[model samples]
Every structure is written in structure tokens, then in C-alpha cells.
Target: MPVHQVNKTIGEINERIRKGKAVVVNAEEMARIVNKEGKVKAAREVDVVTTGTFSPMCSSGLLFNIGQQPPVMKVSRMWMNNVPCHAGLAAVDCYLGATEPSEDDPLNKVHPGRFRYGGSHVIEDLLRGRAVHLRAQAYGSDCYPRRELDKDVTLADLPNAWLFNPRNCYQNYNAAVNLTSRTIYTYMGPLKPNSRNVNYATAGQLSPLFNDPYLQTIGLGTKIFMGGGIGYVLGSGTQHVAKPPRNERGIPTSPAGTLMLKGDLKQMKPRYVRAVSIVGYGCSLSMGVGIPIPVLNEEMAWFTGVSDADIQMPIKDYGYDYPNGLPRVLGHVTMEELKSGEIELNGKSTPTVPVTSYSMSLEIADELKKWIEDGKFLLTEKQEDIVSL
Candidate 1:
């Protein structure tokens, strides 16, 4: 029967029980519960038989059978169908946990093979992103040797710093040059379970909700129009990419999804802040495990109206101000004096430490107070152990 028809039939049977024209009866049946894998986890055998009879004088007679037992054959059939249903649900849950990819998944275009540069194979730019000078240049580094260039030499005229003597270079060099989608692997939990030899674009395809464009926009500088376009890092993973604000279409559709920046770089020191209010999931922002830092400027603070607090510290002595300074001092604080109330900090009663003082010592002192209260580090034991004992 169709679902609606089955429900209608059940409704009629229920109506018969309510009316005085029906005789009531009782019965019992068997049931079982099973895991998604179709393995039966529980089962119970039951006996069901209803006793009822219709009156001979009644033209429209009713037979009522109720209590515990429905048809065993029908119930068993539904129960078996539910087993596959449960199994499918569980498999989907496991797939979500085990197959989800992360933002750091690398991008490469070519698979590494037995190819040598300058001898048999020619080098090519296989990855996206404009090349920037290495933070530190080493003498005789694998980086391309600097060549004398004319005054008109552009970035294109520069040597390919990425190329190396492939034959003698370390294995790491080869991996860097020839990496491709097939060489990528994924991890499940702490274990590297499978070698995912799929296209690089397909890395994080498992998560329908995941969007890297929104992340790339985070901490990016706001563009202030001038006669010329503001400088931008052009290419993959750069902030110049157009990100859709939270709207009808786009990764983020709300203010929380929109990325914002905080702090003035012109100050004595730079600060950074996250303007977007993100919700972390198992690894997302709501749970707060992942660290999404401001790109470069370190001056930062998180502001929630009514109770404003500094979440970022000054780049210089940011450590000192952190736990006992102007900003809400967080982290380890070791106080020699015991105070009864919440530790209030400021110029008035804040304990100041010399810049040269060891931070670990302060941490130790703070821990000592807790130990003393717990009676673990007794004064008498300290005297006996340290002094001529």
C-alpha cells in the first residue's frame, strides 16, 4: 500500500478501538536492532495471538486485535529494511570524519619522474604564484645564480630561482619541482591511511561547505583608491583574488563570514586582528583550535561591544603587557603576594617586571603559589632538603 493509504488504514483501525462497536484484543511480536553494516546487534523472539469475535446480530461487524503484537511478517520486513538504512547513515558519518581535507593541501601540476635538468629534461614553471626572493639568500644556494641585468630588466628577465642541479640535488628538491596531483596523500586522524592520487583541484571536494577563497581574504588589506591601483600579490593564494561577501551566492553569506582587519600600522608597533566572527567546527573557528593570524601587521585586538578586551599584544614587549599590562593580561602570572580578589592590573597596582627577567621564572613562581596552597611544596620540606639536610 502507499504510505498515505497505510496511514489511513491505521487511522480507521484506531477509530474502531475508540467506538463502542468494537471488541478489544491483545498480541505480541518479535523485533530486532542492527548496525549499519547489516550485522544484527540485538533480537528478541515473541509470541502474539489476539482473541476476539464479532456479534451475530450486528450487520456491520468489527474485529479488534491490539496490544503488543502487529503482523510478525510485516514488522520483520520493515526491521530488515531499517538495517541498511542505519548502515548507510553510519558510513556517511565515517566518511565525513575520515575523508575531509584541509586548507594546507598543496598544489602541483606535474608528477616527479626520472628526469634530469640540463642533461635530458628541461625545467618549466609548473606551479602558480609569483616568485618572491627567498627571505634569506645563502651563498651557492640551489637558487639560480644572480646575473648582471640591464637597467630595463624586469622580473621576467630574472633567472628561475627555483631550478636546481636535479641530478645531484637532494630528494627534497626533486619533490618540490615535480610534485603533482597524483603524488598527494591524505591523512585520517593521526594515521596516513590512503594515497589520494586524484586531481589537485579535487583535494577538498569531500566538504561541500569548505571554501578557501574566504580564508584567503582574511587578514588581507583594504584597498584605498588612489591615482594608481594599490600594490597586490598577484596569483594563487594571494589576497588580490576577488572574494564574495556573504550574500545570496558566495562562500560567506553573513557579516560573520566577512573578513575584517584591525589596528593602525603607522603606530610605534603594528597590531593585527580578525574582523570576521568565525564559527569553529571540529577544526573550524567555532571550536577555536585553528589559528588564523593576521597576515603581517601584528597589532590586533578582538572587540565585542559592552566588554572590550585586547586579544593581541604589542609586537615589542608584547610579552610583558600580555599577562599584566594594559591589554587583558593573559597567560602565566606568578605573584609573590597573595590577593583575595580578581587580579586587577594597571599602573596603580600592577606588578612590573624588568624586561631582562626570565618569563619562565615568573611562571614558576605562579605555579609555586598554587603548589603551596595544595600543600604539595611544604615550607618545612624545602628547608630540610635545601639547607644542610
Candidate 2:
């Protein structure tokens, strides 16, 4: 790979961004430009490359101020649409988790509440303009004498309601295959016993963190398209693991860099951000995130050229005993191989299905570019070198 001297600085990039003259392209188009125009030419032509993702991030929830009632109370216990929410924050604030099921749900008594609706569903309903029944109880403090109350609430009914997800994106995920005799259930979606089907998550080459495996460009305060609203990267996600096995392109072959996303839930569009209940799996929030990377040099242009063929990953046997020992690796496969719709496994061809939506990601990338072009969004200044290796 040929490296060219970079004349562009962070200041220069921001200046172009501010003036709405920055040359920007989505990951897909950038890859094409790099392949045909070559790195040096592409690097100089492109200032920013946008990347995106839409995945099931269970580590998400809603923060709501259920409005000021006559008898104000620091809500200790609460339920919305029959689904319980965590009211442990403050008098006016509450946190409703995506995976949290109703305590009184009968499904909890039997097994994981696969069909039981949770906080995530409530969030979607609110976004859809559906009213949710809100009930709360308090010890009745002198300042807040309310004991119990019931009312219906929507996103409009609350003064402040937004999604504050500590972690929302996983960099690299496992290709799930079941080798067990019985059907196994997992967060990767259900795996058919005996390698009957293969399910993979994440848009490999199009993923934001996958393109910036080293986290060199993406860092805290980076502006992004979160769900339907503009969101910013707060910091490293909860289970962030920077260093992972890499391919020739330096893309991780295992679970690697993750992102913590935050944005205004009220501004979010339900189409781009919604909650889902995967049958027999769990409740999760499906959200879209788009991050733009500044190609300040030729090296970055080369990095942007990474294709599905260059993105390597392992097929983790979801059937294997986890934690006690590493998940057994069934085999190694590239993003191209997986995207081909099939990968040869154990001398037999196995079909691959995607759990996450790639089209959603592509849409986010284009939307983000428009946001920049219209001057509605600006690239945020890096506050810290938090993404560095």
C-alpha cells in the first residue's frame, strides 16, 4: 500500500465541514472510488466517509419525566402499559430498559419472556402516538405527598423523554452455528441444531467501527445519525475491546470495538429507531447509527477501501459451552463469503441469513451525508483521544 503525505488537518476538515464544501461519500461509494480512482487520488478527493449500522442493541432504554402532577412524588415503583419501569433515578426521572419485562408477566414464571412485551415496546408505541398507561407509587414525602396515581402518557405528554443507551453498537459479532442435538436459543437469534442454518449480524464492510477498527478517527463527541435523530458518540461502549485479531486490512476477526450512543428519543423517527421482541429470544431496541470519518490522508483512503473480502471473522459454535471455555470456532469466514449468501462448512454448503438490516445502514449513511450537505449537522470536535489503541 502506498502512503501519501497528508496536507489536510483536523482544522481544515472542520473548515470544509463548516462551509458545507466538504467532499463526503458513504462507505459504499468510497470503496468504489478507492478501488477505481486509487488511494492517492481518492484520499485527496474525499474529505469524509460516512458509515452506518442498524442492529439489535439490548443495552438500551428510555429516560422519561412522566410530567408534573398535582401531587408530586419521587416515583419509587412504576409501570407503563403494564410493563414495569425503573424509577430509581430521581423524583421526576425514570429509566425504562428495553429487555426489562413486566414483573407480573406469567411468561417470566416459565422461561425468558420471549413474547412478553417490555419497555422497548412501550417506547415504540409512544413514538407511534399510542398512549401508554402510567401508574406509580411513592412513600409520600412531605414535599411529594402523592401515594398512587394512574394516567395515560405519550411522548408528548412527558416534558422530557429520550433514549440514553449506555451501549448500542457491537463492532464485530459471531457467525452463529449450532452443532448441538437440540435447538439452542441465544442473542444471535435461534440457531438450528446441527448447523442447519447460519445467522450473522452487523453490516460488515458498511459498519462504522469495522471501518475504523483501530478507532483512529471515531471518538467521543463524534456526531452521528442515531435512529432517526442526530446522536453523538459519548465514549467507549460498556464491553469495548479495542484489540482483537485482525486481517490484512486491519479489520477485526472477532468481537472488537463497540460504541456508546446517545440522542433525543423525542426527535427519533420510529422507522429508523424502534423496539422489537424477537420470538423466544429477547426484547431489544433496533436503532440506526451513522458516523462520518475524515480521510485526512492516503492511509485513511486505503483503510476505507476495505471490502467484504478483507473483513475476516470466525464462526462461533453457539452450541458450545460458553464462559467455562471459549466458544468453539467452527471455522473462519470473510464478510464477502458470508454476504455471498452461503459459506462452505464441514464440506457442505450452508446458507447465511442476516439478522441486522444492511439497507437500513445504507439509508442512514446517505441521510447523514444529507445532514452535512444541508448544514444541519456538523462534525463534532474530538474532546479526547478516547478511541486510540
Candidate 3:
């Protein structure tokens, strides 16, 4: 097997980036280069590859440090815009999950209600400089006297607003379809009866984890583009499977790795962090995330060279099998075939749609590349690698 004669270090790559001399390319471009010139040549020429994904991440949430009341009341319960928040932390600190539905939403009274607003909408409203009604209940105490508090506050009024997402950027995911006769709604959107339509989410070859497969350069303390601002990888996210089944290209065929990410909400753009509501499911936050992989060795170069055709996802039946906790997989399909607007399944050509925005992902990857080329972004050495088994 041929090997690249050059082996670069992250420090060397950062130095070159600082001097505006580093070679940076998006994952798509790197795949083409590897396809034509092979991994050996590609590794010798490229310094960095940028990857991106923009999708509805339900595990995302916001952390806020609302200022204490005048008498220092200890908040026992809190609600922002009628959406309940987890207030078991400090006196004034609270965490609001993106999927928390409003208490007054008609879903409580009606089946398959349209969940218009929820925690995600409140988050977006706050980020956009809008004030939300805040209500808190507290048990009166001698040290902390004030009990009831009601007011409207904007993001600026809070001491700290942070986006702490437990999971985002799923490495690979399921292509959902309905196997029953009736329609059903899920986080993947609505599925038509009898597998009439398929919905999948991922940026394919441009996804950060897909490009890094084994978590080589992506890990703790690795800097990334989070919701249009700089952020850091906290650790392995929830439901992250270290070792899942793989295809010939060494890519996971099932839902695999995930990222735990955190960033300053004050620096995020409203465009990159928006609210989304499923017809019958609930609310979620759609976010844009980008990770840069430094080409430090032949293996790194080869991994970044993976393309849509090389990546595949398992097909899952959401109508009956998934809801019943069955692990049966209907089949597998490549990202290339999914992107072509159709796929052959069960002896029929089925229509498909991507729940995530591929165009936004491309824009993010391009923007990250520009940040590196302009000497504004620098790669960081990971303190520890994400778990890989």
C-alpha cells in the first residue's frame, strides 16, 4: 500500500494557518481530490477539512442564571413563557429543554395537536432580544423571604445565557418510514401510510463525524462552530454508541457517535439557532454546527475523503416497529441514493426527503473554511479523545 511521504502536526498546521499559508478544503472537495489522486496524494497536499450539519436537535437546551430576587428568594419552581424548566440546580440557575411543551398547549386536551410554541420558541425569542414572561414560585423563608415573582425579562437581563446541548450532530441516523396503513407523526416528521415517504437527517459526506469516523482529531476541548459562534466539544453526547456496525468503508451503518456541545448563547446568531415544531410530536431546536479536521496523517486524509456514496443509514419502520421497541431494520440505503430524490425499497421506488438542510450545511462548511483561510480560526489539541471502541 502507498503512503503519503508528509506527516504534519496540529501545531504546524496552526502555524501555517496563522501565516495564511495553510491549505484548507471542505469535505466534499477533499473527497473529489482523493477520488482522482488517491489518499496518498491528497494527504500530502491538504492541511484541513471542514464539515458541517444543520438539523433539528431535540436534546438541545438553554441554561440561564436569572438574577436573584431583591430579598434573595430561593426559586423552587420556574416557568418561562408557560414552559416548565428544570430548577433543581442553584437558587437562580435553571435549565430549559428544547422539547418542553407549553403547559397551556392544546395537546393536553386534543390528540395530535399542533404544538405551535414551546421551550425552543422561547429560547429563540430570548436570543432575538425579545422579552418573555417569567414566573417563579418559592417557599418563604427567613433567610430568603420573597416568595412570588412575576416579570418580563430579555436575554440581556439574565447574568448568563448558555446553550448546553447534551447531544447534537448524530454521526449517522435512521431513514424513517411508516409500515402501517395509517399515518403517524414522529420527531422525524410525519410518515405517510405504507412507506409512501421516507425522511432522513444528516449532511452525509459533509457531516463532521462521518469525515472523522473514529474521532481521531475531534474530542474534548476541540473548538467548533456552534450556532454561528465558536464553541467547544464537552464530551461524548447522550446515546453515543462507541462501536456500531460498520460498512466496508469503516463508516457506521447505524446511528452512532454524538457530540456534547456548549457555547455562549450571547454570541450565537438567530439564523443558525431557530425553533421548530412537529405536527404532532413537539418542539425542537434546529442548529448549525461545524468541525474542522486537521490532516495530520494518511489515515486522517483517507477518513476525510469519504463521500455520500460511501455512507449508508439503516431504514427503520416508525409506524409500528420503532414505537414498540423492536430492533428490526427494514433495510439500508446509501446517502448518494437518498440524495438522488428516490430509493428502491421493497421492490418499489420510494420517494424521499431530508429533514435536515443540506444547503445550510454546505454554507456552514464553506464559512468555516473561510475562517481558517482568513487566519481567524485555529485548531486546538484535544485534551482527551472521545470514546471509541
For every candidate in turn, the CA RMSD to the true structure comes to: 35.3, 2.1, 1.5
Clashes of each: 16, 0, 0
The reply for model 1, stretches above 4 Å from the true place, is: 1-114, 118-198, 201-212, 215-389
Tens-digit per-residue lDDT, 192-263, candidate 3:
998999999999999999999889898999999999999999989999999999998889999999999999
Clashing pairs in 3: none
Model 1 residue-pair collision total: 16
1 against 2, candidate with superior TM-score: 2
Q: Write candidate 2's Cα lDDT for 155-212 as tens digits.
A: 8989988788888678788888888888877778888888988889888778898777
TM-score of each: 0.13, 0.94, 0.97
Alpha-carbon lDDT of model 1:
0.16
Error of 3 at 78 (Å): 0.7
> How close to the true structure is residue 275 of candidate 3, measured as C-alpha lDDT?
99
- Give the TM-score ranking, best first: 3, 2, 1
The ten-residue window of minimal lDDT in model 1 covers 168-177
Candidate 3 whole-model C-alpha lDDT, 0 to 1: 0.93
Candidate 2: pairs in clash? none
